[model samples]
Target chain A: MRFLLLVIGILYITPVLALSPPTGRVLLTLTGSITETNAGHTAKLDRKMLNALPRYSITTKNPWVHQAHKYSGFSAVDLLKLTGGKGDLLRITALNKYVIEIPITDFTKRGAIFAMRKDSHPMSVRELGPILVMYPFDDDPKLKNETYYWRSIWQISTIEVLTSPSKE
Target chain B: MVKWFRKWLPTSKLQHWYVYGLLSLIVTITLLASSILLYSYNGNQATKQRIYEDSLWNALQFQLQSYRFLNYLVQIDKKDLPLNGAAYTQYDLLMSRVDLLRSGEVGYLIRGLTGGRTVRLLNIITGELELISLNLSKIEEGDLSYLQDMTTRLKQLDNQVNEFTILVSKGTNLYIARQRRALGENLENVRILMMCFLASLFVLCCCIAKGFSVFKINQRNNKQLLIDIQNIHEEKAKILTLVAQEARPQIQALLGVPCDNTESSNSIKESANELLHTINMFTDLALIDIKKLSLDITTESLQKNLDDYVQIFSSKLQRKGVTLVSYIDPALPDVIGLDFKRLKEIILELLLNAIKHTPEGSISINVRPSSLTPTQQPLNLENRRIGILQIAIKDTGFGLEHAIQDTLRASPTTQDNQPLILQNNIGLGLSLCYRLVHLMRGEIHFSSEATSGTEFWVDIPYEVSQSSPENISLYSCPDPKRALIFTTDNHLANALRLQLSSFNIEANRYLEGPYYDDEDLDLVIIMDSNLISPEIESNIKQWQKNGTFVLYDHQLTKDVQNKAYAAKAQSLSFPLTQSRLNGLIMDAFKTD
Candidate 1:
């Protein structure tokens, strides 16, 4: 009876220790202060894994388009939850090596999202896709300001959660 | 070809008005054409400017829409709304805006302004929107991390697009400025063209005014010329009438007497005839010179006329003791185109010159077909086959003096320089002859030596006529009869005796007394019937009853005329011609 209980405990803890690796080509990677990861010290995700997060749809205008467009993707809060990341700031990188930093509250309080599909279609790299950051500028008029507009990143390849300098 | 061209050209009389009207029409047409061209050019430029401005405005609208849509998308992302059909619709609308900005005329304008960078910006924006659209599923699942990054890139794109819009506005404004400058230049050109047209019009008006003045002057001159010509014609006609009517009759009277029996009488008669012929020739020449008369050309016997002329002057030659010789070619045509009156004057002039100059020598006149040297022939008569009758009159006398020859060689305009004696003699005669010959299309040449002789030759063209001509000569008295003349004038009695002797008639003259006692007389001629008394008249009647015919002169009293008529006598007028005297004598003898 003792052996069976130990076996059940090990089985329950093994999943927490070893996360399932990405089944397809990795589309995004999260590092630094991330608790849940499929690779060591980092969380690697494919298109399928990214789709498994809590979904959101944003209908808003951006500097790149003339009208409001519907963007379907996971909220940054849910993506953070999936990676088990805790940070005061988040640094994002694009495929072109372009980088930008944003406050963690922009994702948690503002409900910003990483869009993977536009108009119900998956975006290609040529479309600045696989990932794009979109603020809910239509819902919160404050997000339509320049500060929030600059925070919205496109063609995202990686994210790094970092603690505040004071906390370090 | 010249005549055809002249037919289309305006005559001198109408040229002024025609040229003025043509110049005015040309100026007006040029003005109209220039105005039309200016208007069309301005209209085309305006159209082109409008097109450029329209394209600029379109580009501006597209850029504005792009910014607005971008703002909307930011709001939607911030709200974290569900991916819905409305959002996709907005996205599509934004994409279409970018597409419009990248192509067509708007694209070209933007590209020109941005150095081709505007297209790249547009492409970037489109790519970003498409990427966002492709990642819609991930974005809808609460993955909002990429929003900040996309917003920053889009902000940069928006800045670039805004710059493109500014460039477009500036380019359109610059185009408008350039077009305005071009328009001003066009207006200036129109002003200059208008000024040129006005100046041309002014010049044309001046020309027309000058032309009118010239035309008026010409008309005045023409009127004056016509009046002058009319005066000349009247004067020529008057002179011609005087010679024909008065002088000719008087000269005929002088030539009526038979003066061959005495040298002095013969010389006096020849001098009177020569003077009369010279006067007639001078008057005719004056008429011809003024173009008031034409030579009356006719087919006549030149030889016959020449013979008559020589015969009339034969006694003058005899008195001068000069032998006269003449020749006529048999090969010459029977009749030729000759102005008989003019030819007579020319021949007589030559003969008189010959007789006057040849004091103690001979004169020879010859007529024949001329083999003229090329230099002697008139150019116009070169190809003609008609007979060239050359008449040459040569005289053995004092040849022309050097001074006289020089005077003759001088032009008629310089005739005043000639000595008065020469001008009154040979100068006047030769000039007259020259003019007359030229009028007949003939040429005359002369050669002379001092104290030797002078020879004159004339070559005249003549047309042959088909008809034969009759010969002209003096009439001869048939028979001679005895007559007694009673005249108070001694000179008249002597002239009558001399005239009667030439006809083979015997005449007894009594100037101061009259006797009708001659029984052998066939006729008695009384010079004046008034001189006869009743006793004499009775005696004449007794004589007439004894078969003697009586003749009375003119200027008789009516009673005397009746007495003479009753006595069966005839009356003769004074100053009788030779033919008239011969006719009277023949009539009287026939009656006897």
Candidate 2:
């Protein structure tokens, strides 16, 4: 009984530390180039060019989804510019070794983005943060299927704009 | 008054106030806690919901940014460069941030970032991304309508998010208002309950105050009653003292002149007779009150004590022309408290008055002794012998006025129906006699006329008993002719010797001393013996055993009486009057 009470006391006080915002470290590493699709063309952007664009969010549902969830991210075109990429097709690889190809023109879609954070915090590797492709499946039922959901890669390690696209 | 009652209330009530205060504190604490909890919960829920909405918003924004970047990549065609360079690395990091937002990694940042319209915009952006990812390489130049259509959808989505946010804000305001009203009602109920408890407590205090006031008033009234009783006692004491002081001297004067002077018997007798006349006058006044008085029957001793009263009065009555004749019935015992002496004096005074008034008639007093006749049959043996004494006094003189005669007849009917008609006018003398008789536990009756005098009768009841002869000695006499002479005064002894000369007594006298020898003493007459010695008494006893007659003075000590009885001597008290002396000598000789 005494031990149980002690456990409850600790549990009751644990939220104080857990509920506070994380401080001190901001960790994100990207080692490959990115591409942008803007005004029906593939374009390359530097970090300064990407930084100059207004920061914003779009909260909505999507349709090419499996496990439907609300998603938040920057547009893929914007990220590619920031990474200095200019190619017709972008090759992306997840830390889990999954790969996908996206055409540069696809990045210019209205609800599409290359997101870096969710709810103001970096995502864990298992949570598919630091690099991932996502769609708001909760907003569009059409996106909550295997086709669209599979293309949204998580644990991404690299994105390279390639001209010699054998598969594409 | 309310304040005073509050003072009397128990400390418990004060403690109750503190309890109420504590309850108020608890309620306030609860309200504060509830308000804080409501604020926190609303904040938490709003933050969570906003995060979900804003995540969609941010994901859409990221999609827009990523699309532009991808377009730039295609336009620039810089695929050969490493993104790790300062400019490229920064762009890669920005791309990573966009990826994290799309994956919902910074979900908390989405709070306040987007709403319903933004959520739709996110859907449009995600759809566009999906379409481009799949079919951008397949689109011909004429498919430009697709990009235009996607842009139109994105703008519509943004508008929808705004509409949703407005609806949520209106809902939050309603929730807050309802919560505030609930809190207010809870506080109001607690306040009302506290006030009711205090009011009831105050009423209880009032009851206690009323009870205490009643007790205090009763105590005050009791104290006043005690004071009143004390005052009444003091007043009675004063009245008694006044009565004693005013009446004692007068009553004492009525008792008589002192009998201390013994010069001549005649002179003494004459003085006594004079005192009797004054008593007679007092008795006359007492009777005058009776003649006109209306009162119930009263006892004689209560009127005045007469055993010691008449001797002094009778002497005075003898000097007057009237001779007081008395015919007393020896059978009646004295139970009536009529002062016998006082009654006699009053009667003698009446006789004198009758003698003076008529100048030549006799006043004969005949008293018929009364006895109890059982009105109901004898209830007990003791009551069968109960006796009564009645007395009547009749006078011969010039008779009564007719008016007085009628009044006498109307004197009030007796239970026995005895007629009493007055023969003379009602005067001080007649009235006095009537009252005196009435005082004897008896009623008065008169029979009179203008020519013949009046007669008065009194009735009383008493237990009559015989004078037992226990005082007479029963002794064996060898000679039956002895005479006994008893005298205590020396002068009386000489007179007794002369008085006994005619009798053949062996005359012996002892002087008042212990020197006399008792050896030859027989037929002993103790005259003037004082301090009789035991040796003399022993010798007298020897003689008495040899059949000598023994008599003693009244002054003999009680020890002598015991001694005489031990010796079987006949003892009697001494100094008999002339008539009694002669009678005693004759009885003694006859007994011998």
Candidate 3:
């Protein structure tokens, strides 16, 4: 019976263990690009580096359902700055190879945060956690369209510095 | 498809709920989809960077292993070299194999892949591998320096790769964190959106409910308004029926009793006449009085009609012994375009009121020339003019009270205390008269006093056509001592007598007869058709040689004045003015 309890505990704790902050020396690069406010800056990020940054979470209702759920992430601005990317457009890629570009300004204007947790717990792959991009879509109805929805990439594993020309 | 949906879901049923649901769904979907995309993208990017780092590390490891093999070969002993063919062959084969492996691209990695102590270690390893594999005995000084240079190049390549890998790794971590955070936020937003949508739908439903309530209230109001209109229509119909019933009996009772036995009928007729007179007087007062006004009247038929009107009005008020005194001016203009019937109604109404109030007093109708600017003059062939007249009606009966006088003067409306229906006949009559006066663009003034009684004076403007020149160019000069006698054939003698006190002319009266009189007279007027007779024509011819004798006819013919002038005599017609008479006298005196 003791052994059986030990096995159950391990099964439950394993996922929690996996969720601990990644610890190591993180390497990163920086690039100069335009931001949403038409300001130029550099940004870059890595796994080890992101784990070292500040974290936060919030609960809110989403477009698809009436139930509210907790979301966790870092400030989108801090994450972009680590990547050394100053472009208005940030192209994020997930481990599953899904790619999407988000406006960097959407982060600064709306207090947008880049998160890695949900309900105070590290997000799992199925939960679209590990990495997710978000904006304060609750404050405005304009974010309810598919354009903004499609721009939020999840399970993010990498970010590339795509040299974008300034449109403004 | 939409029509089918409305059949069951009928927007009216769940409009509010549906709106909220739609809003919530839209918000949540957008946020969730965006978060998923960002998370997946960050994950892929991180994986790619990791793979590339691994590839670099593996490449470096492979380079190091090859260097170790080279070092082992270099450490081989030349002193214990193979003395026989078999041993030499073995050694040579080993050396060749080493050369084959170390040469080309793989050899270059081993040669250049260096960083920190790793570069020196590879150099040592490669030298040892070459010596052992190739059986070399000693190393040249020049070769030693070259080997050291290889070590330096390897060190540089290792350093570069390490720096690049570290930078890329840091970038990957940050990007992943960002994607993760964004995903969380999007999810939160989606949740919030769902709530908002639901709330909006609730509001929409409330609005629809309110709209329905409003529609019901409006319908109720419309129904009430329709009922009110029906009630008003019914009330008007009932009033009309009552009026007809009352009027029929009163009229029959008034006339039926008169047509009975002879003696009673006569007595009844007298009373009836009195009643009729009172009724007639009321009718007259109710009508407008434009016809009673005058202009230079050449139409005698209109005078006869007015006389008939006066007689009718007088007979109705005999009970009060109310005498009607009329003084119609002969020079008044003929009333044209006037409603004679309405005029009679107004007069009759006034007469009735006078008779009713006055026990024994005269109601005088006086007409005289108005002092106001006369717009019409009587037709006068002699004076080239016409006359204008004004009329005033006064009652020597119960005088108008101060209050009535004030009202009449202030508003041009006269009210008498006479009752007719639910209202007063006098009030209606006065209001009608006031309105008529305005319609004719005339003025009506009221003058009254307790002692002298009340008077209503109407002023009407008129125009007349005369049988004279529109513009006169008479050569006749003025003379105070002489006059021109003009006559019409109808009772010329009597007509002359009516003018006895009117002109400053000597009587030159002569019927149709021989002229055996004064040959030195200043003027002579002939009205006899005998003026057209040969004997009279000759006499007038002889008379014109010594004096002036004017010939006129009953119907003053056009251009007759010119004919008289051609005959050297001044001819005048009836209705001649004093001024024209003076002018004719002056002309006659000029030749006297």
Candidate 4:
């Protein structure tokens, strides 16, 4: 009976907890298996909306970039928790429609950040970001390899979360 | 084989080599194991996955987006659609991928594969897309010129992008093959190392096994050798007992009772005794072969035995006119524990050898306690030294030749390695005596000159019994007479002093010459009578005065005897025994 009430409570409170619609140009979208929404099932976020949620900064060397840079944005784990994400997998797509599925645990375990700004300025498309999922490659030597480098998807546009068996 | 190696492999000296060999083997094994581990570690480090897989994605993504944007443009021209956000977004996607080819990990990969052709192509595509994106709003319906131009370029770009994708796939496959081969080499090295480790371990175990086997064999051999030595001792004892009981009496019985012929009778007895002596000697030699002979320790009165033996030999010495001088120490304890039979054999052999060599000269046999350097005890020892007995036999007829002196110089060893002279250039009888002295843990050596004499000295250790002969008061029957000793030999002089002291005689010795004037002395005694000269004769005449008895070698010519008689001196054998000294003192005092 308590579980049912908690479910009802969450459902009723979910509409109130839902994100406000993006006010400026929509830059990123969160869809599928998430509770936080603005447009029925999708949460469209602009730089203001993402920056408004929470923020962190990382100064790190990346394989794609020529030099070390500072990126500020919401952490993937924190962003997922804010959206009430319930999933085993996060399917992220870049602006070029290049898609890759990363385990949600990868983001939480590695502390990858979805960066909206570089060097305190909003990143342009030419910078490989409107928002970039920048892994702290310099923080961990293991991230220099192909397995983790593929997970550092740039120019990230959308993330559709869904549940799946861990073995696969 | 092990015996050979035992001699070759010296102990203690080669011990460090053994340790060094083992240490070197361990070092080799350690180095080998380290090498195997290091190789595998480096191989793993070398094959660690790198980020070049992103290049394959970049190339394939670029190809797909090129055609999609071109098809989107064709649709916009055909459907008469307005210029919109989708065209710009698609253009922006194309531009970003081209930028990645120009600057990202993809750029690094493409330049290595085709010398930057794909990157240059992507730049051209980037410019084309940018131009189309700017003119998007100016496009009017039925004006498909920009669309036609872009589609043709997209077709050309798509084919080249597809080629770049194939090139990347081949390169990735080749790199994976090389890494797999390196991993295979590391595994092979580990396998070889394991095999070598097992082989060396097996070799070490075999060597240890061999060492243990050799040690056990040596232990068993040592045990067998000790048992054999014990058996030899038992067998020799049995043989000695058998000879004493069975063979000897029969040999003694071989001679009939003596007819009334003194010389012939003496010869028979001498022959039988000689045969018996030979048998005893061979038996002792057998004992010497095994170990230190077990002595039949008996408490013996050495004085009585020496007296009897001297009596038996005196008649024969008389026949040869070789005056016998024998002195037995008065200080000898009345009874002492000794191997008397062996000592008798030694004395008999030495005396017989002396008699055989001397035709007509003085032979002196002196028995006294020898004061060779004492054992590691205080010099005094509270006067408790029941001393080592020394018997000296000197014959004045014929001295030893040079060859025999060499043989004597190579003295006999007392151990199981017996004197080789038993079969060497020495008389077999003396050789027996040497073995007998050694069996008693004593030493026998000789000094001889070519013409004067040879002296055989035997030192035999014995324990004195509690009963000693009577002290000075017991010999009160003798009137004390002054006797002057004249001899150059220190040993004979000392023996003569001991013998004279036993008789309660006042005796003084001059070792170099008679350089004093003591006219009251009753007798003048001299040794080696070969040492007597006119100077000694003048001293002797003055000392004896009324009647003087002097000693000189019988081998001297009549002229020497006449000179002694002209000086009113009587000649006697030298180093006088106690009884002879007693008789001489009685005569000297009677004349005085």
Leading candidate by DockQ:
4
Q: What value does the lDDT take at residue B154 in candidate 1?
A: 63
Q: What is the C-alpha RMSD of each candidate to the true structure, in Å?
A: 32.1, 34.7, 28.6, 15.0
Docking quality of model 4: it rates as acceptable
The order of the candidates by lDDT, greatest first, is 4, 1, 3, 2
Q: List the global CA lDDT of all models.
A: 0.68, 0.47, 0.48, 0.69
Q: Relative to the unseen true structure, what is the C-alpha lDDT of residue B67 in candidate 1, on a scale of 0 to 100?
A: 67
DockQ of candidates 1 onward, in order?
Answer: 0.01, 0.02, 0.01, 0.33
What candidate 2 gets wrong by more than 4 Å, as runs, is A1-168, B1-316, B333-361, B370-385, B400-403, B414-441, B449-452, B463-592
Candidate number with greatest TM-score: 4
Clashes of each: 92, 155, 140, 1
Proportion of native contacts in model 4?
Answer: 0.57
What is the C-alpha lDDT profile of model 4 across B108-161, one tens digit per residue?
666676566655655665666666565655454345567677667667666666
TM-score of every model versus the real structure: 0.32, 0.23, 0.25, 0.44
Every candidate's chain B TM-score: 0.38, 0.28, 0.30, 0.50
Worst 10 residues of 1 chain B by lDDT: B413-422
Candidate 1, CAPRI quality class derived from DockQ = incorrect
Model 1 residue runs over 4 Å out of place are A1-168, B1-155, B181-185, B188-192, B195-199, B202-206, B213-217, B236-282, B289-291, B302-333, B342-592
Docking level of model 3: incorrect
Name the DockQ score for candidate 2.
0.02
